[model samples]
Target chain A: MSSNSSFPKNEISIIRGKCLVLPGNDIDTDRIIPARFLKCVSFTNLGGQVFADDRSELKGAHPFDQKQNYGASILVVNDNFGCGSSREHAPQALMRWGIRALIGQSFAEIFYSNCLSLGIPCATGSEHLIKDLQKTIEADKSQVWELNLKHENIKSSENTFNLTLETGPLKMLLTGKWDATSQLISQKKNIEKTKKSIPYLSNFDITN
Target chain B: MSKGTLYDKVWDIHRVADLPGGSAQLFIGLHLIHEVTSPQAFAALEEKNLPVICPERTVATVDHIVPTISQKRPFNDPLAEEMLSTLETNCAKHKIKLFGIGSGSQGIVHVIAPELGLTQPGMTIACGDSHTSTHGAFGAIAFGIGTSQVRDVLASQSLAMNKLKVRRIWFDGQLKSGVYAKDLILHVIRSLGVKGGVGYAYEFAGPAIKKLSMEERMTICNMAIEGGARCGYINPDQTTYNYIQGLPHAPNFEDWTKAINWWQTLASDTSAIFDDEVTFDASQIAPTVTWGITPAQGIGINECIPTSESLETNERLLAEEAFSYMDLKPGKLISGIPVDVCFIGSCTNGRLSDLRAAAAVAQGRHVANGIKAFVVPGSERVARAAEKEGIDRIFLEAGFEWREPGCSMCLAMNPDKLIGRQISASSSNRNFKGRQGSAHGRTLLMSPAMVAAAAIEGKVTDVRKMLGSIK
Candidate 1:
């Protein structure tokens, strides 16, 4: 979304929402938000263009375009989601489109970090478990899914799937340290100290 | 402590602190910024009232939105003009050096850095662009960060990042003529798959890599991000030093010896251990081209498009999708595919040497009728060098548009784009769907010489065969 919205900055221990399953692997950033839509000065209104080409091509056949999945807050996808281009628009578009959490077999390193910075936890599960969850969610669009980060598990009516997140991101999401700028600012003194030690930095005239 | 890899040594030296989590606060030695990703970052800084902690450490340029054909002031596209003006304003406000239009040093962020000697060995470079790994050619630990991370770097001159596992990608022997660094990286990606390098920093080493020129090494590391590595680098050596010796921003003559001595120690120790090791024979690689959406879905120029049966179960669906999207038949030979456009530019292959290689192929030949071909230099300096060497005249005589420096058609942020379903043989990186500005445009990624050959034939012809014909 706009990122300036009053979304909670921390306390992402648990989340409950409808899951929209998008079956595909290596769904790159280009597909998440096509390059054409990346020309805007700001990321606002990107939700409408999320999967713009795919949705137009599929003509409402894509899960995201379907009426039943209109307000889905969680997305379940196959392996290696968000694989190309380091466009932050991918996660921004998804977040604007109402996705608050993502569960997939894997995610591109940069994409995962971008999502985490927005307080969106990208958890991973085994293929079978993810597929089963996707199928179950597809069968009933209204089914509620519970993602418990504290316990590292996702539960639907019929099954509970184990999800895993790296400890670094997990802590960042939990404590709102996801905003590295804040932490960096708090450590300004230390950073300055280190900056002075770098020979190249000393070459620059740093007034701050 | 035991010996460490180049990545380890660089990481250890730049690491400012180990954060509460397992991540490290890494001091960024050079921060390169372009028009597209920095506007939001500067906006964030403005919103927070944070002055750029170290403006001298950061350099700005306008690339993605600058039109290669007509880069005159007040671009036809209002948005492009706005982006450029915004960058100029931000850089002026923060006192960051910007290589704007007409600045001889201005070019794609990746291309200008090394040539200016702003990119150095053992440095930690960060840019708000994914291809920032291109600087790793100098043995630097480089990373591509998002706009927010760009903001983080601007505010603190550091980035909080998780340490990546080191992977040694050893290649032996010598690359055959006509096989370039693009092919080698394509071969590596094809073998490892796109996601194989996730959570790792690839250290490209061995006899083959040692033989490549600095620009060629940059080409190899440029696409490392395409294979899912956060970054990729080669060990700096005498070649690296020679490239840096007298450049504008390089160490002065008095400091040169001391700088060389320090850089020599930045390479990985012979006994350094890695988290993973993979090897390939240079002889095994050939002139390669990507037929599918991802860089990993490539085949040798002489090879055929793979059928679903030939792919792993997980790869079949995407392959099938690619077949349909590209309007290509499975098992069809990649060489004979007709091309409508041939582009030689972008940070991946728009260097001076790339232009020279393409110019050699286009010396007496002309672009095929009805096929559009163009060459955009990686930077203004590259363009000037090509012009001085008469490479631009050769390309122009060959009926290719010799254009200004900018990231043209690479992501197609400007007006240069493939209209309709025209298939392109492009030297630029990424063959993603609609990556060349047309929703249905198809891109076949290849080397500049191969693109030159493809332009002449209006088909995906092998450069080696064309070389013989030219001789």
Candidate 2:
């Protein structure tokens, strides 16, 4: 879990893993990575610290601590998963802890964007659909599953489920343009032009 | 699809390019940075060999990690010191204005930005902290970003962002005397659920919103993230102009009228159309308090926590989880719950107005026996102002430890934290487990005045009972 995967700065349309189920709703970023652990200059050691508070409180009974869920890189969670704070540390921790994608009832906006930037596709599904998927994984922890953002579906050998994501983000994941700094930087001319047009940016001077 | 709303106008105004992914590259008019989230972003920029394209637009501050009890040269906590030093080194290297500790303007980024008038209307502001929405009190469209986006902003001065749908939250009437903006926001979250504002920029409008002071408006917008709205804003008015008029970064006298005219035009037109509209009656809101980890799980001071069977099927699981995590029984009254600690600070409610409201409550009252109660101003300016008004003296006399300015006990990144399972009556925003430092620590979110009242009682007490109509 501590190994840094060479960030494949390319299309992440497909994510394969054994689904790990974490039940309950509004599972905030604080629970994902508690604020106490966020006192670092780097996110390198965050993998071992993800769910530090919850896992410690559960005393080895938490899903992340369970042996059956090992190698589970696709997390199955309930509603409002990753709901508090804008700490990218939450998604970075999950990514470093072996999660490649997330399927939840919903996700907080900032947390979702953080995951997208990290190339972790957060797919959403209907309540019934997500619960069914979570139960399926719980009943058979070893079953391998694959989420295809290109086709917008999650599939195991025996089952396939539909998931929903915004088209704009879908395009980003499919086009490997999720890493957006280059794209933004590439529009240097427009950036300057836009900055010049903003009144406050130029101290309200439009002429100069 | 929203038309003529501030969010729409600001988004269009800042659009630099139509990104291929259907997202727009929008220029960040004001880029705010803080110690906790910017370090990694700076590291990424160095790793990528990129230069900060618009260093002038970015303003740095040290808040999330600084100790509220001490403002020494190097922080006592080694890791906290390292984090702050990393920010100092990065800001120095980038030539961004670092409002380091003791830079009279240093405080919570959200607090200082607005206080110094760096936050203005018709701007698209972005910061790495979720409470960045606090700047929206000036009618600016602001949002919280992650470290990667922070890096993106550093490299390009912009973000590839999808324009958010606008939801005008119309408030009718005025907030009752005892109720404040914090109560209103908590009540809204409680009614709407924590995820209600996802993908939507909340437009806090109508008569109730208009009547609030700019600082009060900031408190309401500050917790927009708590309800899943990355951005929440109030349109600028004369109140906004008055607040920014004399501040350090406000437009100069020559540009004041021009700035006001431009700000006036940015408000939502009378014929504006929104993606959705939700209305609330301000008079209906009470001194709301959270009884659960998520901000949405709140009840009016007089209300009892609902049993699982009483909630909707979708809300039941979280309700059960809340009951256990908070160690409270179903149908228990939220008021009268004993608290071991009381904290009054955070980006959400640490402004001078918040302290004044709390100080008004603590004027002649003493904190309950054995309660560890403290007050931390949002910024040095707020601290100085409170001291000038003898508000700090009032708190100290009432047995509340008046401390320095920082985001203390809110996220608990510094040493100011709770000891084991201690439930705090906090004026901070989030009430999440371990949020105030201890792994099992509990937090009951309320108005600062309510936190003051709770400090007096060593339990969750309704501020309305103690209020002699301060407003």
Candidate 3:
């Protein structure tokens, strides 16, 4: 609910459309994309392998197997999602799978930031609320949860939850002003300010 | 007389300037790099036509993509080979020391740094890997960086960053028999929830931490990221000094005195302030494993998986998914969940001590039939050390494949994998769906000893049964 109109508005970015919610918290990066696939620098082919080693033994119908969910957009996850490893590939894979946004009780700090940097919107809510939304989706596979990024809210049936974002990060996402290097680039002027404030840093020979 | 906490002291000493926003531009004292994440950062440097500014302050290693089966040039995977080559070339060109495959010190970057004494107290360390916090066992401040940030470090030898508020996690009491560092951390993660450490660095202190060996301390710190903290560290103490005393990169006698003094100043003052504080009783922890697919979903081996009715609405559905994926019953005890494989290697628990712990459990008992158990040393040095101690023979004799050094089944690199929804008891961190290289594969994270016990039993079981008098 900021005055600035920076993020893409109104369009619902669905992540994983797969409706596949792994139970529990601390779902780590290694489980998202086994280290085998990490050798490739490009994220293009990683989506196909997302949970590759994990899905093969399913007895019958599983979420990833549904052709319709193959292109599902929203990723509804459990509490404390994306734990373990700073591997950005975890988010990259989820994104490539067409995940536009994730609604979870919470997210791993680095993974959440990585998602934001890649333009994937992540929203957090109470564990009880997120669980309700996840259950609603599970009960009806076709059910869709609506997220209003501009309003910083999400709705599943009659239940609604607010999303939390720290001030500076919210501004960047809302204004579409996020360029990974842009923050540092803009800080060039501040680097000079820093030097003047902490003169001792100037004497530390960085060239060594 | 205000005594600053370790976090406050470190923050104050390292603080360069607070940014206009809430972040800090704290300086980095040492940087470590690995083949996987550094290649692109090095490429970025090439694009900028820049030379590494402080090669002496940086160390590099090959770990992630190295094959645990063979120690040869040019890996079978073309992509893995290229990444290895890129790191070698980048380090050679930059004059940054790299521990290549088969190098005496070559191992997981985190393990190699501490083993070589490259990580020290009162320094801020950065790496492209999250486990870089492992160096914090030496009382240094360490953080993981992204590819762009890796470039920032290589080009300028500094990172533009925010200062983190520190949370002092004071653990009291002594660990009961069979409880390891892995269990202690898992317990902490469960209590705090995985996101509890967000926006903070965790300072692990108190008598329990002070009593643990340096390697055990590393295991605890290595998983700080898993708990949502950017980094976790322990203050330098007698255990720390003793561990580094004769190591390769540690200071000499003349410098040792000065180094210890500086290290002493790095500890949190008794009156130091913290953004938050939490405490745990070491006696409350137990050998734990994930009942569901996530680390935080874990309970002690003796516990049962929670029913949907026991979980929050959002968590219930995930529990349902876990039930189907893990093929487990909600009310059943997690103690005997069948395991198809066992893996004991990764940055999290792949050091020599980890191997020794697992070896002790596997020494006399053979791995269960149909269970593919393996032991992958985190580095060549660890492998060599294990060999010198005949730990390899112990593992091999017990039916666990003693493989070459590298992250093996831990993340399913190099073909050491789980197949057809196989469930594994893993010492390496994490237990996410398909984290072991198969779509339906499941992982149960546990202590190395517990992993060994499960490997032999072919099911989740308390390691205490196998421990039998070993404390």
Candidate 4:
């Protein structure tokens, strides 16, 4: 493994942690971070409040509230997780809560993109494999899980599941091309040229 | 050259470049920013020492956190004031146009954009708000992006996006009276599960859609995101052209005809292919209401709450969760469910037409004694128009408090909210748990007219039953 000090700032090709299995499908953005908490000026300190209402309602029974899952960095969920609202806070709250990667049956498109933008890799596996992996993690909470993005495999001490990521986002994660802002800045000259060609944009002046 | 669908034409015209991956960089034609999602994005741009590349393409408005009761300087909620001031500072720094409170144009971003004619056929609109899809009513490709994506748009006037498959949702028959556009969309979302449109852009079509007013079309498109679509659009026609002809920001007379011709070409060719299609009979739709948390978990007002057996195996768990959260009993009739609050406003149903519909219902009837009712306009212009039409007086006479324009009681960012476990008949979008401020507060989503009916009856009453009296 590469030294921690040498970790790339823009891409994550691998992640290792004890997996925390959240047993539910369509675990929407509102549950990930309640609308109440979204009023904050910044995303900072949102880690502590991720799943705040759900955890409270469950009375410490939520997987994330359990002591064994405290530092778990990989989150495994059922199909269609983060399915409602285009709230980026959902992924931001998860990332801040120490989740470095997500493996599930599937994820909502916007949520997947938000996670990818943050250099967090979200992968998928068949329902059977995902459920089996969740069971393995639950039976022994201490088992370390490793997600190898380059090889498309997720492994635990007793099991290995084949994982798949969309080719577009996978390439973006591997090559650090997910940072669209930087890419946009680099192509400024071309954008300026485009702006000049569009009559509506070229003729737009604040004075007018 | 291949004849393209509306989505393809818009996508191709806006595409800046193909990125390293299978994503395309799309130049945004308009960027609408609001108080809630823009602060962090502006801060990020500041950190990167980046200026807004094309400030003219971006427009700023304060909506989410602004209090509807009193929108004076130094807002009662310090956080709300700070958010507004931050937007003011950012817009001033970047030379971006801002419709701050008291500006005649100030309103919900989605509502004001169309009213100002900033949303047009064949344009690509991006906003840091979920209801950005509301603009797609004008035949534009609109996206609701996250704050980071907002920063990307502000810094480069473009966004990197993977193309979406197109799905044509065609309505086969005319809507029955009392079945509003809100009901039509609610029916669509319920029939097609919440996750059905995950990777698609929906094209709303058929004779029923073409017959809708621009405002009604906007109401339908506003909740396209609720059905999990990336965006939704309607092909421009005479109705679209007529609506944009006189708007201040629309193309002048010299370019108007040319613009209309180009917009007409953006519609799907007769032989255009679609990845998927769904057809709905609009005649069957009634005034709809969400009994559970999700927008999809809705039924006709007269229908009973869905039984577990009626739900798919995977949806059962969420249904149970919603049942518990909403304090609703499975298989119980959705009608006569007592409502403690009646809220008539949101980006989804706070436009002028929505206000007129609600006012029509409230003309002579008084709100029930125990029900707390309020009517909020979507924009300052809407508020003014309502006042001019005596619609505000009708609401006031009906005992519904008429308030200033903003996103009030929608997400409950401001002072207006449901007190503890109060069930609300809300004209807003989204019925997610605690979405209306109180952790236990419950919202039942419906049309503005339905909400007005609920206020008068003090329960879930059919808008159709009250329509005869109003007429």
Best candidate (score: TM-score)? 2
Write the residue-wise lDDT of candidate 1 on B1-471 in tens digits: 224898888777677887876788988989999888888889988999999988988998888888988889999999888888989999999999999999888999999999999999978999988899999999999989888898899998898898888899999998998899999999999999999999999899999999999999999999999999989999999999999988999977766776777787889999899999999999888899999999999999889999999999988999999999999999999988999999999999999999999999999999999999999999999999999999999999999999999999999889889998999999988998888988889999999999999999999998998787323
Local error of candidate 4 at A55, Å?
A: 1.8
By DockQ, rank the candidates, best first: 2, 1, 4, 3
Candidate 2 lDDT over residue span A1-208, tens digit each: 5533455469888888788999888888888998878889888889899899899888999999998887788899988898889999999998888888899888889999999898888999988999998888888999999899888899999999999988998899899999999999899999988888987766676521
Which portions of model 4 miss their true places by more than 4 Å? A1-8, A197-208, B1-3, B469-471
TM-score of 4: 0.96
Candidate 4 chain B lowest-lDDT run of ten:
B1-10
Q: Candidate 3 lDDT, tens digit per residue, B1-471?
A: 123766666555555555443455565668898887777677777877877766877898887778888768778878788888888888888898988876688888888889888888767889988878888888888988766677777766655555677898999998888899999998888777667798789999888998999999999998887778888999898889899998898877666776676677677777788888898999888888887776667888778888999887746766787898889899999898888888998888888888988888888789998998888888888888889999999999999888887767766656687897788888877676776777678888899989999999989988887887432
Q: Which stretches of candidate 3 lie over 4 Å from their true place?
A: A1-34, A44-79, A93-105, A116-164, A171-208, B1-3, B310-314
- Note the B-chain TM-score for every model: 0.98, 0.99, 0.96, 0.98
Each candidate's number of clashing pairs is 1, 0, 42, 0
Grade the docking of candidate 3: acceptable
For all the predictions, what are the DockQ values? 0.48, 0.73, 0.26, 0.44
Q: Please give, for residues B61-84, the per-residue lDDT of candidate 2 as tens digits.
A: 999889888789777889999998
**What lDDT does candidate 4 reach at residue B56?**
85
In terms of DockQ, the best-performing candidate is 2
* Residue A11 local lDDT, model 2: 89
